[model samples]
Target: MRRRAVVAAAAVLTGGVAVLLGVAVPQAQAAEVSYATRCIPPSGIGLPPVDGTTKVEITAPAAAKVGDTVDVVWTFTQAASRNPDIIDLPADSVQPSGTLKAAGAQSADIAMRGPRQNPPVPKGGAMVLSAMKGSLKLTTAGQVMLTPDAYVVNALSTDTSCAPTQQVQPAATITVTAGSGSSSGGTGEPSHTGTPSHTPTKTTSPSPPASTSTSPSPSGGSGGQTDFTGKVVNVPYTCQSPIGQKRATSPVQINARKNGGSYDLTVQFKKSVMDSPIDIPANSVKPAMQVVLGGADKGSVAVEGPKNAAPIKQGAPIEIPDLTGVYKPGATGEATLSPGVLTIDALGTRTTCTPDSSTVSLTLDTTEQAGGASGATGGSGSSSSTAGGASTSGGLAETGAGDHATLKALGLVAGTAVLLGAAVFTYLPGRRRTR
Candidate 1:
C-alpha cells in the first residue's frame, strides 16, 4: 500500500508541472524570406529607379483561435541599395510601414507600423530600416497564409516607395481554430490598421457647411483677386558649390496675389557673388526655389525662373532672375509663405542651397472653394526641368550606377556625392537688390 501511494504522488506532481508550463508559454511561428525590391524615390532629387534586395523576417503566433487578437511583427533583415546622398542618417530618423496580404479563411490586408529604432551608421553606409508591428483578429476559424507586400520608408523627410519586382511567396502560415472560451480582447469585426472606419463618413457631412461659410469674405470678393507685394526678408543659405561649400545671405522679396481659386507667387533673389572653380557656360545655370507654405496650409511649391542669359566667369557675381510659381490653397485661413531649398544646376553639376533660417516672407488669408473642393493638394509641387543637364530637385538626392553614366565619366561616385552633401552651414553678409 505504501509503495502504491508514493507512485501516485509522483504522477500527480508531473502532471501539474506540465499544465503550468502550457499556460506560461505560447507557441510562436516565424519565417524568413528574400524579395527583389525596386524603389522609386521622390521626384526632383535627380535619382533614377534604384534596385536592391530586401530580406524580411516575420513573427507571429503559430496557432490562434476565433476572436483572438494576434500580434505580428516584421523586421527588415537587409535594406535596399545605399543612397550616397544620405551621408548621415540620425537615429530614429527612419519610419517604416507596410502591408501583409492574408488569404485562405480571411481575405484582408494587415497593415503594420514600427517604432523608430536604429544604431548610428557611419558615412557611405546603407540605412537601417525600422521594424514594423501590427495585429489582427481571427474572425473565422481556418488556416491563413500571410504574405509580404510593398512598403514605404520615410527617412529624413524623404519618402521612398518600394515594391517587389517579382511575384511574392507567402512568408508564414497561421492555423486558427474555434475559440473554447471568450477571445482575449477580440471584437467580431475584420482586422484593419491605420485609419479608422468612421473617417470617411465624418468627411461627407461637415465639408459642405465648412466651405459655404468660409468662401465668401470681405477681404476676398467672389471671383476676384487680392494682391500683397513688396514683402522683403533676408534668408541665409548654405550651398554645396563646385568650388566648395559656401554660405551667403540673399535678400528675398515675395509677392502674392490671391486669385479666386489659386494664389500666384513671385520670388525674387538679389545679386550675389559666386566664385566657381570652373567656368559656367551661357544658359547653363538653372535655378529653382521651393516656396514652403505654413500656418493655415502645409506644402511646398516649386518655382522656376529663366536660365542665365550670359556665360558666368570663374570669379564673377551671379545674377538670378525672378522665380514664379502657383500656390493653390488647400485650407481656409492665413497662409504663410517662406523660401525653402534653392537648387542651382550649373554645367551639369548640381548644387543645393538650404536656408539656415526660413523667415516668413508673405502671409495671405485664404478660403476654400464653393464646391467643397480644397484649392490645391498638399505636398511638393511638380518638378521643373533642369537647364544644362538632368538634375534632381527637392529633398535628398538619389544617385544610382545605372542612370549616372555621365557622372561616372566625370569621376563622380558615391564618395564624391557624399562630400557634396555634407555642406557646412555659415552666415554671410546680406546682399540686397530691388526688383
Candidate 2:
C-alpha cells in the first residue's frame, strides 16, 4: 500500500512539470522570431548628415512564421517635387513563407513645416490618421506580398506651396527570403552608429519657389511612385554644326518610392557640347522645391555662360530651343553635359560626348549630299542640254550596243551618208542637168 501511494504522487508531480516545460519552450521560441524594427532618421542616429529630403526605410520582415512579427519604419527628410499639397509615405506587407502574418504602421511622427528654428513641416506633428497600422494574416504562404499605402500631410504655415493635404507612398514591394535574417531598415545613407543626438544649430533661410507653374502629370509608381531613373550621362545623340543642335529626352523617369520626400539629384552631361545652352527650369513642376544639375560647360539657352545656367526644380519647365535651324548638315557640334540636359539633333548626326561643361554646345554636319540636287551637278544646279544629250547618247549606246552593236553602228553610218548625198546632189553646185 505504501509503494502504490508513493508511485501515484510522483506521477502527478511529473505531469505538472511536463506541462510547465511545454509552455516555456513555445514562449522562448516566439521571442526570438518576434522583433520590433524602427526607422530612425539621421537625427535619431545623432548624425548631422542623416536627413534625406526624402527617405524610405524597411524595419522588419514581411512574412514571419507563427509567433513572428516584423517591424518596418520609414522616414521623410523633406517635401518631394510632385503632389506638393501632401506628404506621402505609404507601405505594405506580405508573407512569402509560413503565413502572411500581420503588419501595422506602429507609430509615426509627422514632420510639418514650422518656424525657421523648428521649421514648419509638410504635415506638421503626428495627427490621428488612417494607416497608422495594418493587420494581415496569411493562412498559408508561397509568395509573400506587400502593397503601397498613402499618407496625408496637412499644410503647415511655413510652406509657400502649402495646400490642404498631400499623399505619399512607396515604389515597390521590398522582399526577403525565409530565414534570411534581413534587417528592418532602409538602404539609404550611413547610420549614426550610436552617436549623441543634436538638432541643427542654425536653420537656413527657406529658398524661394523655383517656379509657380504646374506641369503635365508626372510619371511614377502607384504610391507617389514616380519612375526611378538610373544614372543617364553617357547616352549618345546626333549633334548639329555651328554649335547648336543636339537634343535628348530623358527616357528614364524619376520614381518616387512609396514613402516620398526630397531627393538629392545629380546629372552629368557630355563634354563636347558646343551648341546653344540648355534650360531646366523649376517653374514647370509641382511640390519638388529644388532640382540642381551639375557637370556642364559655360552655355545657356536664351542666356549667356555656365554661371548663368539656371537649375531645374519642381514646378519648373525645361526650356529647350528649336534645334532645326541650328544643326546643319556636314557641320560638327559638341555638347559636354551631365544628365537632365535635353537636346535634339536636326541633322540626325549622332556624336559621342563627354562630361565637360566647356563642351556643352556642339554642331554635327551631314557628310552626305543634300536633297534636291542633280547627281551630275554634285547636288548643285540643273544639268545643261549638252550634258543631258551626252548622257542620253552614252546610256542609249551602251544599252543597245550590247544586243545589236554592229547593226546599230551600221544604221547610223548609212543614215548620215544618205543625208549627205541628198544635200549634195539636189542643192550643191553639181545639180541635176534637167533643171
Please give each candidate's TM-score: 0.44, 0.16
Task: Compute the lDDT of residue 110 as modeled in candidate 1.
Answer: 87
Clashes of each: 5, 122
Return the TM-score for candidate 1, rounded to 2 decimals.
0.44
In TM-score terms, which candidate is top?
1
**Local distance difference test scores for all models:** 0.57, 0.21
lDDT per residue (tens digit) for residues 41-95 in model 1: 6444334566677788888888888777788888888876553433444455456
Using alpha carbons, what is the TM-score of model 2? 0.16
Least lDDT summed over 10 consecutive residues: which range in candidate 1? 200-209
Candidate 1 all-Cα RMSD: 21.0
Candidate 1, superposed: residue stretches over 4 Å from native: 1-26, 180-435
